[model samples]
Target: MVPSDFKALIQRFYQLQSERIETYRLFEEGHEAYLRTGPHYDFEHYKQLVHEITQAFSGISKEVLEIKGRLRELDQADLCEHIEKLQSKEKQKLELTAKLQLAKQQAQDHPEDEGCLEGIQEIKHEIIKNKEALSEIMQDFKYDSEECD
Candidate 1:
């Protein structure tokens, strides 16, 4: 039987992928909405949105690297460190994903105030990219595990 932790990790990866796709869909919605809003909204809001999206993208890219590290065969200390980083990064991604979704919802609910819609789009795009990268990492992990068996 597979270790519980490893199995759970694989499940979590797939779930993250699904969520990432959903984020992309939401982002498309945000882009269309932004076009509809025209220039009535403050440009500062768009800039802020881009900034937040950039942060989320950076955070997810970092997490993908951590996950790749965790998949490597390493000593106990290194494994522990990588696992910790993976957990931390996962938590951060979840938090940012929730924040992005909330921002998108708020924008949709209040079309008059695009607020953070631009940031939402950025988050969605980042999620799509990161999700693919993470999935590849997970596949590599699986293959490595199988090779060892």
Candidate 2:
């Protein structure tokens, strides 16, 4: 039989996964609505939906960090280290994403500016690099988790 604390941890993990899925679904719906409505779409509402998705992911990420701390406390050092690495990669990805967004906005606001265009391109490359790094981290975590099972 599984220990109660481990079971509870698993349950919480599943719950966070479910919430992330639901949040992604809502964000997709809002995106589709915006695309369909085109120029007439309410940008604020779509932005709010995007914000909700970000908040949902942020909440899950925080929980995972806490879980990693718990695992460390329980002497599951390998798993905790994997989680820590994943979290670090995730943070880098988030930072790159924010930079990309800012660069895109600058490009949009100054379409004729060569510097702005160059900045956007550079930021896009950085974002792609960070995404690839994050993907590798995720794969490593998956392999580690599977080995544990």
Candidate 3:
């Protein structure tokens, strides 16, 4: 059978997935380093990480959305839906992370208070859960591409 024209889109989607995974790992490391409980809690480093992650997130989200609609047009509605779900989760994570950054910035003014890290772990856990679900979706995407062969 001839290869499907949509195979390139699928490969691009995988690239987005990989980029997100790399960014998320960096985020997790930054988060750990920013916590007061950690020995290397540098406010400046955390701030830089937040900025980097935000930029990365924006880029990935833009591409994911573009691919999402394109996938739908290519008659891959199921794959589109899966990506949309992941997109939604990623948006939620980004929003919560922004809020966390704001809280941390304020906490910097009051180092005596230890409430800054309150919900950080919760948000991280939520992201991990969503990520696992999205990984399964990616597996489905891989199988879906088999039709292209």
Candidate 4:
């Protein structure tokens, strides 16, 4: 049987993931507008949106890391190993998120620069790749959870 605390963590993780996805969608919409219209894009609003989503991502990542640490303390070797792998992926996700934020800031600061626009596009691609990797990691975690049962 799965521990109640573990179940709770999973639920919270899902909730955070849902919020992150929605925030990402909004950011994508804003980014697409900026890409199409260039100077007409609302830089301040775009920055604010990215900043908000980044903050949310930071909070959720921190909490999930804490939960993973707790899971590691449970003394179940296989489960602990699985959590470690998940944590590693989470770290990569956080790094990608930071890169994405930096790219957005650069694009905002240098709206007229082609290099800045290209950097944003490249970083967006990296973020999407990282998200796919994260999805696979989550799937692994689910499989691990069932095996633990």
Candidate 5:
């Protein structure tokens, strides 16, 4: 029989993914406001949002990854591996997002600061490199979960 804790852990993982989708909506809203803001975009706000949620998600993912051994013991190795891959990719995207926000803040805070715009350009390139990774993973999880679908 599956342990109650395992079920709970899985539930937490899906719950986090749902929250991530809502988070994406917030990002999209901010993105669409580009060129419309009066003084500046709210990079500071998003920076804090990214930092806090990333920390929280990292903690949850750590717990989930630790439980994977038990998942394998219970013959759920495939699911365990999938989570491992998705988590790594998601981490990369989150890191770049944090960097992008910082660059935006730097540019906004000091328009005269050298390289701030270039730095954001570099981060955007990295984001474009694997932009589809998150969407692909989301689609895969969506098929299996009712959380973010």
Candidate 6:
């Protein structure tokens, strides 16, 4: 594939990866909400969503490897490092989001108390910043190559 084709492939991989990640995120959110509200919602839906997300992620993992191989600039270790970082960051984001939701619920339950809402918002802000940094890292490979041309 030409460089343009490779770039397009990379972009598509990122899009699919994002979709898969978002699916998992929704499952996480649903799980958290269920934990707070007891048996009020369809917890099974979240479980199914998680299953589907895992399947989607499995498919994308193969595609990511194939695309990276075609790009010829990334080795197995490099790809592994990126995958590890993405996975770690994603897990952290989910955990932080869950904590934020729990804190919000506590604040709601205690109307007069402001228990760690500011801290929760700050954590959320940091998560956003971390996500932006991850996005930059993902793009770094493509942009760095362009600079050589």
Best by TM-score: 3
Tens digit of lDDT per residue, candidate 2, span 1-149? Answer: 33456556645755764675576567556666755554465678778877877887798899987887776666667767767776677677556655765565555556788898888688778867866875676566556644544
Write down the TM-score for model 6.
Answer: 0.56
Highest lDDT: give the candidate number: 3
Tens digits of per-residue lDDT, candidate 3, 38-81, equal 44457787778889988998898899889888877777777787
lDDT of 3 at 11: 79
Give per-model TM-scores.
Answer: 0.42, 0.66, 0.67, 0.64, 0.57, 0.56
- lDDT at 67, model 1: 48
Q: After superposition, how far is residue 135 of candidate 4 from its true place, in Å?
A: 2.4
lDDT-better candidate, 1 vs 5: 5
Q: Would you list the C-alpha lDDT of every candidate in the order shown?
A: 0.55, 0.67, 0.73, 0.69, 0.66, 0.62
Sort all candidates by lDDT, best to worst: 3, 4, 2, 5, 6, 1
What's the lDDT for candidate 2? 0.67
Better of 2 and 6 by TM-score: 2
Off by over 4 Å in 5: 1-12, 21-55, 112-115, 128-131, 140-149
lDDT by residue (tens digit), candidate 1, 85-112? 4445455565666677567657766778
lDDT of 5 by residue, 1-149 (tens): 55666566567767766766566566646644542452666657656655666576667667667666666666665556767777787788777876786677678767897799999899999888756776676566545433312
The alpha-carbon deviation from the true structure for residue 65 of candidate 4, after best TM-score superposition, in angstroms, is: 1.4
User: Candidate 2: where is the Cα deviation over 4 Å?
Assistant: 1-54
C-alpha RMSD of each candidate structure in angstroms: 9.9, 4.4, 4.4, 4.3, 6.1, 4.7
